[model samples]
Target: MNLESLLLNNLHRFPPRVVAWIEKRLKAIPSIRQKIDKEYDDMMGGLESSLKPYKDRFPAFTELPAQGRDRAEILREMEAMQSQEEDRWREGMVSGAVYHGDQAHIDFLNRVYALHSQSNPLHADVWPSATKFEAEIVRMTANMLGGGADVVGTVSSGGTESILLAMKTYRDWGRAKGIRKPEMILPVTA
Candidate 1:
C-alpha cells in the first residue's frame, strides 16, 4: 500500500501525539520531503494559470514606479480588468459574488458610493450622515426581521466582521449573565 493508505489505516491505532510525531519524522526524510514538495508544486502549477489569468496580460509592480502612469491609461487598464472578471458573476454563473447584478441597481449604488467615498463613519462628528444611514439600516433590518425596540445591532463591512461582532456580543452577554466560560458551536462549513 501507498504511504497515504498506510497512514490512514494505521493512524487510529496510535494516539494523536504519536501520530503527529510519526508524521513529523516521515516528513523529515529527504525522499519523503522531496516527494511531498514535488506533489505540492505540481498541484500549484495547475492552479496558478486558472487563478492568475491576468498575470501575463497585466503589468505587475514589485516596487513603486519612478513616475506615475497617466490617469486615463490606469482607468483603461482597470476597466479592461473589470470587464474580463465580471462576466461570470454578472451572468449568474458564479455564486455569492454579485448578489444584485442589475445595471440600474449597480449605477444607483455607484452614485451613492461616489458621494460618500471620502466619508469615514468612525468620525461620526464629521460624517453624521454615515451614522444616520447605518442606524436607519440597522433599525429597518431589525424591524423587518420581527425584532422589537430592544433589538440592537451594528452594521459590519462583511460576513467575517459580522460573525466576529456576533461572537463578541454573545461573549459579553454571557459574562453579564455570570457565565465564566462562553462556548460557541459553529458548523464545519462556516
Candidate 2:
C-alpha cells in the first residue's frame, strides 16, 4: 500500500504509542527511510498544485521585487484579491467559515482587527487588551456550553491543543502516582 494509506490505516488501528514505535522502527533502516521520504515528497508535490489553486491568481513570491512600490498600488491589489475571495465565503459556499458575512459586519470586524493588530497575547502585560479579550472569549464560550454551576476552563486555541494539554496533564498525574511508562489504549475500528 501507499505511504499515505499505510499511515492512515495504522492511525485508525493503534494508539499514539504503537504508531510512534512503528515509525521509529521503519526509520531505523536507511532504505525504508529513503523510500518513505521519497514517497512523502512525491505525495506532497502532487497535492501542492491542487491545494494552491490561487497561486496563479495571486503573487507566488518566487523572488522579491528589486524596488518597492507605492502603498496605494499595493493596497489596491490586496483589495482586489479580498473582493474576489469574499464572494464564495459570503455566499456560504464553503463550509464552517465566514459565519458573519454581511458587509457591515465584515467591515466592523476588520476595523476591530486593525485596532488590535499589534496586540499579542504572549506579552499580556504590554497587551492587557488581549488578556481582556481572552477572558471575555472564555466567559462567552463557557456560558454557551452550560457554565453556570461548576464549569471552569481557560481559553485555549482549539480542540487538538486542548486534547494534547489534557493528555499531558493526565500523563503527569499518572507519573506522580508511580505508574511506570504509562500507556493508554485507544480502540480500533473498521
Candidate 3:
C-alpha cells in the first residue's frame, strides 16, 4: 500500500493520543519533514502563477524612484492594468464576481472613496466621520437581519479575520466558564 493509504488506515484505527504520537514520529523523520515542505512549496508555486498573472508582465519596484512618476503616466498605467483585469468579470466569464459593473456605479464609488481616502476609522478621535459611517453600516445590517434595537455589531477586515476574532472570543468565554480547552467546529468543506 502507498504511504498515504497506510497512514489513512492507521489513523482510522488509532485513538486521538495514538494518532498524535504517530504524527509526532512521522514529523520527526528528516526525510518526511523535508518531503512535506517540498510538497507544500510546489503546491504554493502552482497557485501563485494563477493568483498573480501580472507579476511577470508588470514592472515591479522594490524602492521609490528618485524622481516621482508623472501623474498622467501613473493614471495611464492604472487604466491599462484595470482594463486587462476587468474584462473577464465584465463579460461574466469569472465565477462569483460582480454580476455587472456599469460606469455610473463604478464612477460614484470611485468618487466616494477618493473623498474619504484620508479618513482612518482606527483613529476615531481624529476621524469621527469614518467612525460614524462604520456605526451606521452596522446598524443598518443589524436592522435588516431582524436584530433588535439592542443588537450591536462591529466591522472586520475580511472573513478570515472575522473567524479569528470569533475563535478568540470563544476561547475567552470558555476560560471564564472554567473550561480548560475549547473546540471550534469547522465545516469539512470550508
Candidate 4:
C-alpha cells in the first residue's frame, strides 16, 4: 500500500513525466488515491490467480511444512513445463527474446548450456571453463574493432545501461579534470 515504493518500482516500465503527473494527480484527489488502492488490489488478485493454474494440483504451502522438493521430482516438473512450452518459441510465434527456433539449433544450445550449467565465472578458481568462455567472447568482440588487441569491455543487458554508464563515466572524468559545467550534447533526431 506504499504509493511511493510502488511508483518507483514501476518507474522503469513507465515514462517519467507520466509517472510524475500520475503522482501529482493522485495527491490532489482523495477519491483517486482510494481508487488506485482498489485497482492495485484487484490487479494483484487477478495476477496471482492467473499464475497458479495448478493451485489445486499441488499441495498448498500452508498444508505442508517448508521443505526442499526432491531433485528428480523438481526436474521432472521443469521438463514437463519445457516440453509443453517449447513449441511456441520453437516456431517463432513470440515477438521477442527467442533467437533460434529450429529444433536442431535449440538442441545444440541446450546441450552447450547443459555442459556449462555448473560453470560460474564469479569464482574463476572453481570454474575456469566459464572464465575461458567469457574471455573468448570479449576477445572476439574486441578483435572486430580496428584496435584489436587493446580493446576491453563488458557485455550488458541493453543500450540504456550502456548509455547511462558512458554518461556517468564522462561526468566523473570531467569533474576530475575540474570542469565547472560538464554537459554532453544529445542528438535531437528521433
Clashes in model 4: which pairs? none
Candidates in order have lDDT scores of 0.90, 0.81, 0.85, 0.77
Q: Which ten residues in a row have the lowest lDDT in candidate 3?
A: 91-100
Per model, state how many residue pairs clash.
Answer: 0, 0, 0, 0
lDDT of 4 at 18: 85
The model with the greater TM-score, 2 or 4, is: 4
Which portions of model 1 show Cα errors greater than 4 Å? 1-3, 9-18, 168-190
RMSD of 3: 3.5
TM-score of 3: 0.72
Better of 1 and 4 by TM-score: 1
Measured against the true structure, the TM-scores of the candidates, in listed sequence, are 0.80, 0.55, 0.72, 0.57
User: Per-residue lDDT tens digits of candidate 2, residues 15-73?
Assistant: 87998998898799999899999999999988997677667776766688788777998
- Candidate 4 per-residue lDDT, tens place, 1-190, comes to 5977787688768887987887787767988778788999999999988788557655456665567878998788778767766786767777755765677888999899899888776898998877777778778878876556777766555667878887887888888999979766767561
Query: Where does candidate 2 stray beyond 4 Å?
Result: 1-46, 62-66, 147-190
**Sequence-dependent TM-score of model 2:** 0.55
Residue by residue across 54-74, what tens digits does model 1's lDDT show? 899989989999999899999
Clashing pairs in 3: none
lDDT of 3 at 142: 94
| Backbone clashes in model 3 | 0
Q: Please provide the root mean square deviation of candidate 2 (C-alpha atoms, Å).
A: 6.2
Candidate with the larger lDDT of 2 and 3: 3
For residues 88-186, what per-residue lDDT tens digits would candidate 3 score against the true structure?
Answer: 788777764564489899899989999989987889999998888888988999999999989887889776788889788888889999999677676
